[model samples]
Every structure is written in structure tokens, then in C-alpha cells.
Target: MDLQISVFLLFILFTAGHSFRCYDCLGLTGSCANQTVQTCPSGFSQCQSLTVVIQVGSITYKTKAKDCAPFCQSGSINFGFMKVSYSCCNTDQCNAQDAPDPSNVPNGKTCYSCDDWSCSNTVSCSGTEDRCIKATWIAGGKSVKGCASKSICDVTAFSNFKGISCCEGNLCNCEGNLCNGAQSITQSFLFLCCSLLSYFLLH
Candidate 1:
């Protein structure tokens, strides 16, 4: 027992004393050109790169970011109008490559999208976007709908927010084009959703 305890202590000390490095950069465009070596803080065991795409009507914006994370799950999140993809590695400067753009051919699924007050518009779902999501902005009493990947619909992802709901099947988040008019949410719930979105954007 003593020998095992001592070995465990030595292993912990070795890991704690080791410094991990990663390529760090954030860009509003599709690619990140300038990357700096960043020494990760303790508890951060992996390097991560994330790509996000937000589409509003005919306009589209994409951003790429690289940083250190305590832990990261490689996956993708889709919110009809927005999409996020993540990649992770466990070695020094391993996040040298940014996540790829998520532009898969349309997968024949369609869902309502809200670019303005009218949530009547629809967009095609692509790739792994197999779910429908609706989120109400409590402050504005308005709701937005879109196609999402099943990964983003995990219960733990939005457990604290009541304004957001995700469902499986086509147009399953709501039954009609004017679904936003009938749904209601609290301001606090929207705030939490925005904060969660911001964390992904800034971090």
C-alpha cells in the first residue's frame, strides 16, 4: 500500500510540473494565420480548435479559434442558423490546424429559420444536422428556429435554460411557421443562452 501511494504521488507531481503548450489564435474569418505558442495553465490537458459558422439570410460569417482546454470533446453543434465544430489534441502545440469548414451537401432536411420578426423562412439542413431547435429570446419575446446536429441537443448542454428546446424529426421543434408567436420564455433564460454562446465565442 505504501509503495503504491508513493508511486501515485510521484506520478501526480510529474504531471503537475509538466507544462503543456498549444497554438493560440482567434480569427473572424475562415482561417487563422497568426498563431502564438501559449503555455496552458494547470488542469488544461488538451489543445482545442473550434470553427463556427453563422448564417443570417444571404449573409454568412465564419470564425476560427484555437486555445487550451481542461478537456474537449471532438464534435459538432448545429442551431439551424449557426454551426460549431471542435477538434482536440493532447500534445504540445498540437492544435496547429484549425477545424474544417462545415459545409456538407444538403441532407434533405429543412427547418424554419428566423432572420427577422417572421420565422417563416426555411433553410436546408446539411451533414449531421439531424435535429430541430427553437430558442425564444425572452427579452424580445421573439423566437428563432433552425436545424441542429444531435450532439448540440444533449440534455446537459442546455439544462439551465428554459427558452431553448430541441427535438428530433423534421419540423418537430414546433408545428407551424408562426411558432415563435406562440412560444414564450423568460428573460433570465435568454440571458443564460447568450452567455453560453458568448463563452464559445470568446474562449
Candidate 2:
């Protein structure tokens, strides 16, 4: 009877210590085609796939990432020239599928962007971007004006770029010569965190 009880307790402990497995990978554009399995850390509740696309003029940049995430809700954020989309699933290895491509259809909103010394250059807004943003950094003597989605515009921490302002309506970004300095730390942190997570999971 003691041996039987010991065996049952061992089984319980083994099940309790089990961790979820997820696919993990990271790459720029097409590099994520190959992925590896990873054991999720304790308390991580979901597997996630994230895709980011940035379009400037005729050039496009893309990134793909997958890892064990802490219960992230799936959604998309569009900032006129940039877009980020993410999907999460609770099942093991459910993040194997790729994220869908971002929509290219113009959303009918327009804003001003700076190129070289020109702040009057027009930028066509797409997706959920509905605000014109102007950010400037006094120390760096840099400024930028562009269209942003509600999510990106809502980020309050600009770090070195103290001059940050946003407005709704077409061509609102061209009203001022002083431009917004830097992108929000939140977006940078998001990308950095995902990169680190993928690195740790792979190594």
C-alpha cells in the first residue's frame, strides 16, 4: 500500500511540474520561416505571433516573432506609415501560423510628414491612423511630423523628445515647423522585449 501511494504522489508531482511548450522564432521579414519548440516559463498562459510592417515611400520593412507570452490579447495597431499586428493562443504550439498581412487600402485621412527640410510633404493615412503628430527634440535639434494611429498617439512617454503634440483633421501635421523628436518608448520597448524573449527562448 505504501508503494502504491508513493507512485500516485509521484504522478501528481510530475503533472504539476509540467510546463507548456510553444514555438519560438524571430526574424526580419522572411527569416521566421523556420521555428523551434520551447518550453514556456511558469505562469506564461499563451503563445503569441507578432508581425510589424513599416512603409516609407516605396520601401517596406517587415518583422516576424513568436514566443511564449503572458496572456496577450490579439489586436492590430496602425500608425499611417507603420503597422503592428499580433495574435495569441492558449494551446501548446498554437502560434505556428503566420499573422495576416496588413491592409493596403487608404483610409481617406491625410497628414503632413517631413522629408529633408520640408515639413509640407503629404502622407496618406491608412487603417486606424486618425491623428497628425508633431514631435521635436530640443537637445538633438531634430523634428518629425507624421500621421499616427490612436494607440501610438496615446503614448505619453517620449523620453528625449519633450515636444510632442497631436491633433485630428487632415493636414494638421503641417501647421507647425517644429516637429516631434522621437518615437515613443512603448513601441521601442515592445520590439526590444520581443527580440529578447525570442533570443532567450532560442538560446
Candidate 3:
């Protein structure tokens, strides 16, 4: 563990020198803004500044994170500290109706969880998540008909945050950790084209 900490600190020093490369390899840290993050093994443990700004009609909402992941790497790998920002914008015929009322969203109506996806504990308000969450718009009306048949969702849908599920039947759930089966594919039409290109050039 001490060795890991030392390695992390050393990376911190290197971060000062290889600033641009550090930006690209940004890891499991919550999507924060203008902060330095450090994690080990996979190697991203902290997100220094998480600046989130949301513009909603007449009101603009902004917040920042001043802490690293909730727990240290040695003892905990699931707990993460991240800044979350959500804004309600105005549509063509609608103005921003809500501004993420704290009473509503430290655990919001939209926040959800899903364990079947075998997702990593990336820090969420409501434990687990929903597969599909949709909201319908409220058109200009007093009663506005049936809430079920309303048609459009008022809020953005939070569905399938993580991708497909993968596992070894009963042994391991390494699919999510490594590259997903879909994107990690090697056999493809493009591969065939590249192979043909090399052969054609040699000929």
C-alpha cells in the first residue's frame, strides 16, 4: 500500500511535467472541471476541481467539488466524490420551470441505479439505477389530459447509463472492467480492408 501511495505521488510530480498527456488519460474520476486527479493501478484517484455550470432560461446554476474521492484507494475502491450539475433549459414554447431544487435532487427524481449491468460503484445518490427513466412534457393546458397519455417526457431520460452485461456465467464479471465486447471486437470489415490495402501496396 505504501508503495502504491509513493507511486501515486510520483505520478503527481510527473503530472506537472506531462500536463497534456495527463489530460487524455483522465480516469475513473467523476466528470469534474479544472482539477488534478490521482488514482492507482488503474491510476485515477482524485478529481481536484469539479466545476459544473448549468444555464436554465433566466437562471444559471453552477457548483464545484472541493474534495477527492470520498474514501482513499487503499481501503475503498467503490466510493468516489464527484460534483454533479443539472440544469433545466427553456424550450421553444417553454421557459425553464425548475432549477434542481436541493429538496428535490441531492437524491433527485431523475437519479436511478442498476446492478444487473455489473457497473462499478461510481458514486450515485440513489443506490442502484433504473434501466429507463423518461418524462413527458406538459403542454399548455389546465388539466392537460391523462398524465399517462401525455406523450413527451418533461425531463431527460436516464437510461442504459452503462452498456451491455458480460460475465463468465458464474465465475467473473470482468466484462465491464476490460473493454466492452462490442467496442473491443477485432474481426471487422475495416480490418479486411486494411489487410487488402497492405497487400495491394506491396504488389
Candidate 4:
């Protein structure tokens, strides 16, 4: 009987160790000042915080989210004019802190952007963006050129764009027919919190 009791206690301890309590939130705009706690599901190894900044023309939108992540990593993604930055941690409720906003200062990098009748418009790079990208769609015969973060330029974020090219120099996208310019970077800081949900979908 003693042996049986010891085995049950060991199982309880193992189960407790595997389950992690973390803060969860999603699709939050502005800030993450208010949040709730929940147990992370199996297969999730870390708590995560993701912040995305999407800019279209002059209007910029931000989204903040926290949940369980498969791994702990911090990186940024920039596509066209939209940019996303994320950070992940392994401690319980470690994601409680919000991510910093994208910087607004210019980084002295430049690239071409598309306009009504031409793709020769110039765009300034911002924040961690340091690459110039030129993407052409084979089916639609459309092309878009803009500045991007190094991480986003390296990743295959757009599978639909059949022809994609990236360069590191100012206005490098315009080397042959493109123009010349520099780039810049920026960040934001706002804390708007809400209830955190489970992070099991991070796998």
C-alpha cells in the first residue's frame, strides 16, 4: 500500500511540472496593460508576445498578442509597408510585459514603391528595415517594390509573388530602372490589456 501511494504522488508531481501557468491575450490593439493567467497546453514550451505594425499609406495600425509558443524566439517581419515584431520567453507569465513599438526614426535606407501609373515612387526605410525588395506577380503581371526589414526580406512571406528580389544598398531595387534613396526605423509604446486565452495553437 505504501508503494502504491508513492507512485500516485510521483505522477502528480510529474503532471504539475509539465503544466505551466502563463498569461494569454490576442488580437489586442494599443496596449497589454490588463491580462489574465491560464495553464499552457501540452507541446507549448514557452510563453510568447507578438506585436505587429501595419502601415498603409498614412494610417498605421498596431496589434499586440500573448500566448503559448512552440519555441522562444524574437524576430521581425516587413512586407511591403507592413511590419511585424515578436518576442518569446519560457518563464511562467513572463510574457506579461508588452513588446516595444516600432521606431519612427529614419534608418537612411531607401527603396522604390508603386504608385498609380508607375512603380518608381521612393519610400524611406524605418526601424529595423534595412533591405530593398522588388516583387513581381506572374499571373497578374503586377509588381510592387518597397523597403523591408532584413528578417522579412530573407523569409518567403509571399508565395504568390513568382519573382522576388532583394538588395541591401539604398534604392537598390532601382539599380537597373529603379531610383535611389535611404531608409529609416521606428517603435511604439502603449499598454492596453485584456483577458489572455490558451496558447496551445502555437505548435
Candidate 2: lDDT over CA atoms?
0.64
Cand. 4 TM to true fold:
0.55
User: When superposed on Cα atoms, how far off is each prediction in RMSD?
Assistant: 5.4, 7.7, 23.6, 9.0
Residue-level error in angstroms, candidate 1, position 184: 10
Greater-lDDT candidate between 1 and 3? 1
In terms of TM-score, how similar is model 1 to the real structure?
A: 0.66
Off by over 4 Å in 4: 1-12, 15-17, 111-122, 132-167, 171-203
- Rank all candidate structures by their TM-score, best first, as comma-separated numbers: 1, 4, 2, 3
Could you tell me the lDDT of residue 35 within candidate 4?
72
User: Candidate 4 lDDT, tens digit per residue, 38-146?
Assistant: 7887777788776767565687777777777655445543443545566667887788887666656778887777543455677777777788887763334455577
Model 1 has an lDDT value of 0.70
Order of the predicted models by lDDT, top scorer first: 1, 2, 4, 3
Model 3 / residue 202 / CA error / Å:
48
What are the models' TM-scores? 0.66, 0.53, 0.19, 0.55
Better of 2 and 3 by TM-score: 2
How many residue pairs clash (N, CA or C atoms closer than 3 angstroms) in each of the candidate models, in the order given? 1, 7, 20, 30
Residue-by-residue lDDT tens digits, candidate 1, 69-187:
88675656555566777787898999999987775678888777655345556778887777777765333555657776675556433311236567877766665636554433233
Give a tens-digit lDDT track for model 3, residues 52-101.
Answer: 33233455443433332211111100111211222212111111121122
